[model samples]
Target: MPNAEKLRSAARLQYKRAVLWSHARRGDLVCRLMLHEHLADPYPLYEGIRAEGPVYRSRAGVQAVTAHELCGQVLRDSAFGRRNEDAGTAEPAADGPPAAADAPAGGGNASFLDGEVADHMRWRRLVAPAFRTRKIAEYRHRTEEVAHRLLDAALDRGGDFDLVTDFASPLPITVISELLGITDVDVDRFAHYGLVTGRAIDGVRSVRQATEFREAAGELDAMFTALVRRRRDEPGDDLVSDLLRPQGDERLPEQEIIGTCQLLLTAGFETTTNLVSNAVLRLLSDREQWEALVADPKLAPAVAEESLRYDPPVQYSIRVVRDTLHLGGVTLPSGTVLMLVLGAANRDPDVFPDPHRFDITRPDAGQHLAFLSGAHYCVGAPLARMEADVALSVLAERLPELRRAGRLRRRPTAALRGLLNLPVSSGR
Candidate 1:
């Protein structure tokens, strides 16, 4: 970017940071979530917001919904949509440029998740075939194989390992890499990309962070651009090549293809990484739960669902009101930005009895909105679930005595929750 544009971005970032800090100091729960101090355990803050009622009108000028029913309603409602690309104003309390809503540093909507209805459906149709049921079944066997291989390597390295780095992180990364036909995969670099992009979800907190995020995003975009060009010349059996294939003269733009690749790579593994680590963390924390899973690895699917409810990878999502609508006893005008607290809604007492308890046997666990609901519901949900199931089951069956070997360190981002380091040992 030009020096003038860089300076403007820095100024805007600082201004947003100041505004966020001020609101957080004034006890705006929504704004407070943006603070690093709250990243460790935002669930308590979520509960506080819930105490205010299902709908919380934050002092920061954004509304948050904590009720399971209400959050699901808003997600499925046609009146609520992604922030229009042409919309001039940013979401209130946005610490930096909107990460998920607007185009990222490299420009263009990075995924169908942020596109308008027509565009979203168009992109979805083109990409949906890759994630169809038949395709997912084919991927499941490979996912299981990858999980076991990761465990084998971790176990061979001695009893001790960092689960996030040694096992949980690489399983899905490898799978996604192969799916994308990335011949020379760089696990460390891709992990770094995931960290940077995930942190961007909460928006940039500093000029330094903003710079780092842009650099990472640019690098990711460049890689995909080259991959797209290569695939066009020598098409292969991969999602990119599949997309490059024409459908009766209908073709995705080159930039959009690059964006789709970026989206798939980043979104594909990040959530599963967290889901696997989070499930293992919770299960190991409670000896009974761990024993239960170890006894019957088939319960791995249940563990995955409960973990999603107990500690979702994505804690919240934002939507813009497209028309005046009354919800949760409040009349919200058009242009109102809504923060759907998926983490909080999953634990709503009215929906999940004894909401705070994490039980693998919870019959209603699958009802959680972890993947969200309606049009914006995660398209890769099946893949994530299958990957997590295989991961947790393999770990339990192979390392039944796995135990925490060191302190847990969480990723310092509120919007996307996961572990940075999960140290563990095969307690032989």
Candidate 2:
């Protein structure tokens, strides 16, 4: 970017941070979430926002909804949509660097997840087949194998191991890499990419972080571009090849294909990694739950669902009012941005009784909106669930004696809730 443009961007970021900090200091729960200090435990603040009623308007003007019903309604309502170019709400700078200047040719760095209804549906349709039930089943065995292999290595190392680094992180990375036909796998680099991009969701905290995000994004894009080109020449049994397949009349543009690959790699890797780590952390924290899972590994799926509901990897989502509408006793004008606190919604007492309690046996655990709802629901949900299930089941069977080896370290991001380091031991 030109010096002038960079200066403007930096100024906008500084101004936004100042406003958020001001509101945070003035006790705006929503704004407080943006502060690093609250990263470790934002649930209390979520409850604080809930105390202000279902729809809590922050001093910053963004409305937050913690009610499960309201969050679900907004997610399913066509009147509320993803942010567009003209939307009044600016993308949080901390969320990541601006896409416009850094975006590659074609459609730039815009995600189809953020596109308008028609375009979003079009892209979703094109890629939905890869993550369908049948495809996920096909990948299940591979996921199980990878999970066991990871645990085997961890066990061989003996003593204590950082679960996040040793198993949780790499399992999904390997699975997603194979799914994408990335043969020259660099596990550490990909994990770094996942970390950089995942944290980007919360926005860049400083000029240094912004620079790292840009570099990671650029590297990821270049890597996918090369993969797409290679797959086009020598198609294989992988997602990229499947996307590159000739779809008579409907075909994704080359840029969209690359973007989709990048999305799948980071989202798929990060979400599953966090899900496994969070589930294990909670289970081990409550020995009864851990013992139950160890006693009956079949409960792994339930464990996964409960983990998603109790402590989802993704904590929140943002939507813009596409049309004037009355919601939660408040009338929101078009262009108004609303924050849907998914974590808080999942723990809504009305939806999940004893909401804060981590119970794997909660029958309605599947009702949570962790994967969101409506058109923008995560397409990778099936794969994530399968990976988590396999991961937890394998760990339970092999390391039933597993226990925390050290204090957990959380990723310093509000939008995404995950552990940076989860140390564990076989406890034999």
Candidate 3:
């Protein structure tokens, strides 16, 4: 059965790839987006897509929208939903890769993102308490402490350090581990799992990757299942424990709890790691921005917001039409998938003036759709923002002379834009 599933997955991927190639040959903006060269700087390609007007029909049989107003309307409309119109035909979301949207239990991270509307709300209600404004504020001090400690170690190591691996990565891993009451988890092993699963944001491109994703999912389930059992036996003052608290009829299913844990672990660190790395890369590239930040470390929050607007961590989000609807001056039938290019929308000149400029002082940068919009907005937005604000502030204060020490290696994924290795000097 597993072999059969793998074969089916392979066949689906090949068909998609072939479609992309065919449309790319005809200069279809949407299909050409999947090309490797566009990964480095896709903004120009987005501009081209936008030039075709608000709605673009690709030979691949889907419509894409890059205009800010249309993208916002599409996202805010209840007629569009996260699930594929045809459940049997799994399609990757626009902003992310092939997620386990409706995989069965013990299959993949059973995140609320994959759940149906009601199930999503139930699961979201269970986890939303941990990310509330007050709860997020409570996490700020620990975030700062973690950031400072990681920087300390990086600086103590002398010359140069890979910020992504050493600092950006570990800080979030530690924070999320503590938040989830996971005491025995291996940080590096979890990081590996995140990378393997994170690649799915770009869809499963190969059979080997699909196999690796399944393995990673199984391993995470096993770990989270063990933790769930342990917490059931002896609960503590943590998110998982709070979740396991006796709620009578409100308690979540055991598998749901495990799935939420897996999702948190997978998503909790990966996006934030990219956000920090991307922000630092941009800041250093514009020496004035970096200097301004160093001179007034209070600008860290602004820097974080602008980074999200200028170069968001998640570039696009896909929505499937649930009913026949007119959008962006085009009529799309039910079952049609619409790709919302968030990175493009954020820089839409109609909304944000001089969209490409990375100005930390951009007053309304917080208006970007980087976290998405409407129903599927990121629940971790507050936590992520808090983490980045602290990370940037601490880096500026502690390493004012920080400079690039080596090459920046970007992760090879289109949906999730982030750095794999960013070497930098501590200027000690």
TM-score for each predicted model, relative to the true structure: 0.94, 0.94, 0.93
Instruction: Give me the overall lDDT of model 3.
Output: 0.80
Predicted candidate 2 versus true structure: per-residue lDDT over 1-428, tens digit per residue: 67787777778778878988888888888777866657877888889889999898877567889999999998898888776347322223442222211122112355566576789898888888988999999999988888888877887887689999999999999999999999888889998887776666666666666677778878888888999999999999998998888677888888888877887888888899999999999999999999999999999999999999999998888887888889989999987778888999999999888998999999999999999999889999999999999999988998889999889899977778899998888986
Count backbone overlaps in model 3.
8
Model 1's C-alpha root-mean-square deviation from the true structure amounts to 2.4
Clashing residue pairs found in predicted model 3: 94-318, 95-316, 95-317, 96-201, 97-201, 97-202, 97-203, 98-203
TM-score of 2: 0.94
TM-score, model 1 to reference: 0.94
List candidate 1 segments past 4 Å from native: 1-11, 88-110
Residue 374 shift from truth in candidate 2, angstroms: 0.7
> What would the TM-score be for candidate 3 when compared with the true structure?
0.93
> Sort by TM-score, best first: what order?
1, 2, 3
Across residues 1-428, which tens digit of lDDT does each residue of candidate 3 receive?
38898788678778778777777888987667765458889899999989988888877556778888888887777888775735533223322222322223234445677665677777778788899999999999999998888877777788689889999889889888899998876878988887877666666678887667778878878888998999999988888898887565788878778878887876888779889999999998999999999999999999999999999888877778888988866888988877788899999998999999999999989989988777767888899989998999999998889899898888777667888899998776
